[model samples]
Target: MRFGILVNEGPFNHQASDSAYKFTEAVLRKGHEVYRVFFYYDGVNNANKLSEPPSDDRHIVKRWSELAKAHNLDLVVCVAAALRRGMKDELLAEGFRISGLGQLIEAGIQSDRLVMFGD
Candidate 1:
């Protein structure tokens, strides 16, 4: 089955992001297809390229980026949610471009299921 996961929590502030990552790995291990992983609210922080966890702590951003890259997964962030939460990326803050719900709609329509994971 094709699955799409949505996250709505921050990395360090809560375990939602960590849990999502593990769930993602487990899903891929079972040979199920993941259509996209959308990060919204505090979860958008998971996509911030500038995040840097301590050496002893889990590097959420790096792990997330690497996992998506390794599996060629569709990692998306909700625009309204992201912007409201102030997790702006360069492309977002520069001119407030389009790359949020449009991507989510496409992913949602294409996937067999839209899975939500968060607090």
Candidate 2:
């Protein structure tokens, strides 16, 4: 099955992101495919590659990046959320390109299920 995972919480001050990551990992291990991981609201922090976690805490940013790289997953971040949180991907910050709900819509239809990890 194809899955679309939507995360809506920041990596810190909440367990939503970690839960999302675990859910994604489980989906992949079950022989399912992830259409995309959509980051909305504070979830956009997952896309900010500059995140630096405390030495004792887990490095969630790098873990998310690895998930995308290892599985060739589409990690989609909501442009509005990203900008509001000061997260930029060079292209967006430079040319002011922005992602929209369309990305979420497309992934939803293409995938068999939409899983939301909320706090």
Candidate 3:
């Protein structure tokens, strides 16, 4: 099955992002496919390249980036939400892109299931 994930919370402030990541990883491990991951609201912070978590803590941004790279995942941050959260094109993580809600809608239509994780 193909899954579309939507995250609406930021890293650290809540566990929503972590849950989304773990769910995506588990889906892939079970041989399912992730169509895309759309980050909205504060979740756009997950795609911020400038995020610097402590060395001992989980690097949420980097973890998402690496997951996208390893699985060839489509990681998208809502342009409107990202801007509101101060995430710019210049600060996008390596595997993340700024896009419109149309992408999320497309993912919902294309994937077998759409799973949303948030506060």
RMSD of each: 3.6, 3.5, 0.8
Name the 10 consecutive residues with the lowest summed lDDT in model 2.
Answer: 89-98
lDDT, candidate 2, equals 0.80
Query: Per-residue lDDT for 32-109 in model 1, tens only?
Result: 999888877777778776766779989888888788778987777787887787766673321122256777778789
lDDT of each: 0.77, 0.80, 0.94
Give the alpha carbon lDDT tens digit for every residue of 1-119 in model 3. Answer: 99999999999999999999999999999999999999998999888788898899999999999999999999999999988878999999899999999999999999999999995
Q: Tell me how far the alpha carbon of residue 31 in candidate 2 is from the true structure, in angstroms, after superposition.
A: 0.9
Candidate 3 — worst ten consecutive residues by lDDT sum? 45-54
Per-candidate TM equals 0.84, 0.88, 0.97
Query: Ranking by lDDT, best first?
Result: 3, 2, 1
Candidate 2 lDDT over 27-109, as tens digits, reads 99999988888889888877666677888989888888777778887888888778777877762211122488789889889
Candidate 1: pairs in clash: none
Tell me the TM-score of model 3: 0.97
lDDT of 1: 0.77
Error of 3 at 13 (Å): 0.3
Q: Candidate 3: list runs displaced more than 4 Å.
A: none
For this target, which candidate reaches the highest lDDT against the unseen true structure? 3
